[model samples]
Target: VAVTIPVSDDPTLPCLTFRFWVLATIFSILAAAVGAFNFLRYNQIALTTFAFILMSYPCGLLMAKILPSWKIGFYWPSDFLFARGTFIGGSLNPGPFNVKEQTLIIVAASTNLGAAYALDILSIQRLFFGPNQNPNNVGWAASLLLLWTTQCLGYSMAGLSRSWLVYPAAMWWPTNLVTANLLHIFHSDLQQEVVRDRLAVFKKITVLALVYELLPQFFAGYLSRISLVCLALGGASGKLGIAADYSPGRGTGVGIVTLDWAGVSQLGPLYTPLWAQMNVLISLMVSSWIFTPLLYVSDFWNAKSYPITSTGTFDNEFRPYDVSRVIDLQTHDLVVAKYDAYSPLMLNPAWAIVYAAGFAALSATLVHVFLFHGQELAEGFRSSRNPESEDVHVKMMRKYPEVPFTWYLATLVIFAALSIFLVEYWNTEFGMRWWGVLLAIAMAFIFLIPTGIILAISNATIGTNIIVELIYGFIDPGKAIANTVFKTYGFNSLHQAHALASDLKLGVYMKIPPKAMFISQFYGTIIGSIVNYAVMDMLIRNVKQIWYFTHHSPLAIDNHWNAQNPPVFYTASLIWGAIGPQRFFSGQYSVLYYGFLVGAIAPVLTWGLHRRFPGSGWNYVNFPIFFQYWGKAQSNGFANCLVSGFAASLTSQFWLKRHHRTWYDKYNYTVSAGLDSGSMFTAIIIYLV
Candidate 1:
């Protein structure tokens, strides 16, 4: 619902108009849960998931190209014309699109997508592992039962307070899953193997040293006060646009923090991005193109650190080039060839760094091997390119020793200063004639500082949009920038208006060809923007009276889903710290630095916690919701807990399971993309209709 227009007479029809659909989603969830369970147990092939993946590229490309080609553009002079990313929990007033209905549909689709993931993992095992391995061994039936039971409880509760269905907190299930993955990785057997080696002893010691020094710092202000401060700033500065006049009988609409179900939906479209399609494509293309090559380079160092084997995959063993085979002990036709592993130590660090520089390069390599490379290796054995026949160029890149810690710190300071300057530039709207562009460039540094630091530190990745949006808004608050400085007489908004330019720069650091990345991302964003806007407008228009902000309405978009509100809370906090009014503690400016602190130090913390007290994994695995005791009234506590357990257990089992190896292994990549693309497609379809 975009803007809630009230209708007091009809109690059943709120402004959102789709509350009934959300209620109906309970059935969809049930069906999906059952389907997912059956698919996982039986190792079923889901054409739906595969089709989505295969079609993603073509659809995105076509959509991007068609609109521009036909010049059938939905131009918005205002800043409200952005694209919706995933529909389930997007912002409400995302420019011109309010797509709450489509968002719910995507949420339903995601439930099914989860099922696809379960089954896909099994399919992988079946393809790669021998047929005898049990795909059903992962306790699929039990998982489904748990999911169903918890969902039932949630639905019953929602029925009692029907307004709880559309809140953002209600969508915490996915975030929990992400947190669970981090927890599992932190305590996985894989890390145990790394620590066992004599050569890696120094690495372990370094990790330990860092953890001890950083843990207290991490907890001190980084996790607690920084986030809260930012949220508060965003809320207080009117940056979030959440009404502050909630004094009873005094014309203060209810505070956003206290907004009801439909109210929270206003924030939905913030989840939308102009470049989602492009981002997905870039992620995939880089993974397939650049990351794959980096993985090959990784083998030079890693291939030799471990033994060389010929028969088994990385899951069963981490050995390089398996070559052993037993033929019933009769003919003994099996070949026993020995190949030497590459030694990365002999390679130049410069070369190694170049090879390893990509988003999630290491994780991508490992995941690709775990799910995909294994099958490719198997295929190589069966093909004409035998080990004895050809000199294959298969090498996994070694881990690059990063630049010294000092370099990252310097960058952080520089960026923070820059971000501050950008804010000043943006303040020109309030009569500060300070150069906006320079300030924007400077502020961009603040974000870049920690983004690089944490990313380089523990390889921890987090969203960078908070800084991006604030800076963009500050630098170019208007919808357009009329300047000839950056190449042409360019006209683009400070934020999404310059998406092409910003992404072009990002693509450069990530090793993507500037032109291709620019084109792909721009194409995807524009196309997605139109469709997202159209669908959102339609849904909001149809449900206008239901979602507006009013006393009688069950849900209101203004206080809840608007982009200028919730996220603004954080932006304001950052600005306050830089300015020093609300900045009480010494670490006020250090808030952005926390991103680096958290990302860099997380691995060490996890390791130390595990060492000091084993089984800390299970406890720490439940990520506490910071600040708020009860997140947006719509959130289901049980659902998040259930999803966390399910994601971890299921992911772990897929890694361990022998059967359905092919499917199980490829689950992560396929499912992430599949759901994203499927929902995008559904959104477009809705727009078209």
Candidate 2:
């Protein structure tokens, strides 16, 4: 019943800078080291969870890193609003009820991040562990809870820069790089066959498009500004009996959406909560359960046609699903595994694009880094295998080891120095230049560090927009953190794009036709994004009050999973100026400390809760619900949240707990990726309308 319209008063619009980029690079490297180490120390489950975290907020960061167009892209509807929380564009931007806007951003980022991570974890587990294994077991749940709680605490302690934990830790594209290399080395002969088949399809398409269609059109329209070349000069143009040339350009004119927020002041207040709640539902529940599986399954079927199963049936590692078995490690003998194939349109094109882009960028990044800093990758990989040694990678460094303790101290010292130095060197329109810098530094160190730490533990690092919001606060102290973070992180819209990119890379590795994969994924992303957008808008508009509670009010709070943006702790940040349970760090919210308490005792809680309330119609033991209400109270609203959470959390657990443990015995990752895109798209359309 509490209509809390969450608004972001922070105004620090820190766009891309050399320093920021450099810092991000360092952060990413550190995160990657952490992720690889985790995989070694814990298991693939840990890596998958971490990757999901990374997908949440800085999801845009992934795209920003990979895609060319989204560099200066806008965030959410708030960007349309001006200083006064009024619209700037008459009909373009959604105007603002400041708090409401911020709340939606935070909620969407958090839910999306969690959903993506959940999907990734399940998929990975399904791939390695097997179909019969129950990943939702006490051990897996305990580990997951432990990690999630740890990350939450870490982020809380460091003020919540979630990216430090999720991004590099998840090893997004890096994992693909490793996977691709492995395939190339062991599955070279298999690759040759796939490459041949793929090339054949590509050639066929190219000829059809070029000869029968393009060549004739090009000859016809040789010189106009809007060239008619490549235009279809067929009799199918409208109802006309005569043959005509259609002048539709493949290039889309509108690059990014621009909104006008001024005139929508009245509309803003009315729609804020509505849209916010819708985003939560679409980004979280609908996308997770309904869409993800569909996309994944579709992709699996597409790739199933060209199998790569190993031939050694008697070998101990003989897995029914081990497609990589085609490569005879010793003999290098290759066996081409085949299944019923399908046409290009059957595949999810958008997912393919995401895969391709991610694959290319990751490959490019690795090449560039190796060429420029080969020693670094080698060192990092070695360090991962041996954490105790002061290897060559660490030895060749120009910078000495700044112990974590020392790093914090230095950060503070540097911040103080910069505050003074910048004040003398530069002038600001605001009188609080020195104060602002100090505050910014304070926010970064105080808020970001702990948030990052906990996020690392939880492995949910994608869009932890706490840093972006903090930066926004430092730049513009008057606005709320939510608006700033959303504008900064969500504006990038990177994850979806990155997902598409990664899929394309999968196609390349599988030897799916390059151009076909490109077309499918490109179209898929466009279709997915548009559908997602439409459904998202509908949900937001129709579900008015739901947004208010979900985004800001305590009613939005859930102890089951990590829903409710500007979460209970974030809300406390405004009041106590400290993170986690107490104003300082105490066991006041021990029940909420998922890692130490919830995660550790999850098995017990699962049993106890169910035993005490037999047939109560609530399953607290489930991963989906367990995660959702880990730190919050449990109730009915948690129903839908648990649906997606359970489906995503349990699916892999069901498969992995009883299956093999390596890529040599894995499920199709491409399938999962596709399902997530397509199903989520379809679900969004259904849910929103």
RMSD of 2: 28.5
Question: What's the lDDT for all of these models?
Answer: 0.26, 0.28
Candidate 1 worst ten-residue window by lDDT: 482-491
User: In terms of lDDT, which candidate is strongest?
Assistant: 2
Cα lDDT of model 1 by residue, 518-557, tens digit: 2233233323323322333343335433233312256554
Alpha-carbon runs more than 4 Å astray in model 1: 1-440, 446-460, 463-514, 523-668, 671-689
CA shift of 180, model 2, Å: 9.1
Number of clashes in every candidate structure? 82, 132
- State each model's C-alpha RMSD to the native: 30.8, 28.5
Report the CA-based lDDT of candidate 1 relative to the real structure.
Answer: 0.26
**Candidate 2 lDDT:** 0.28
Looking at model 2, how many pairs of residues clash?
Answer: 132
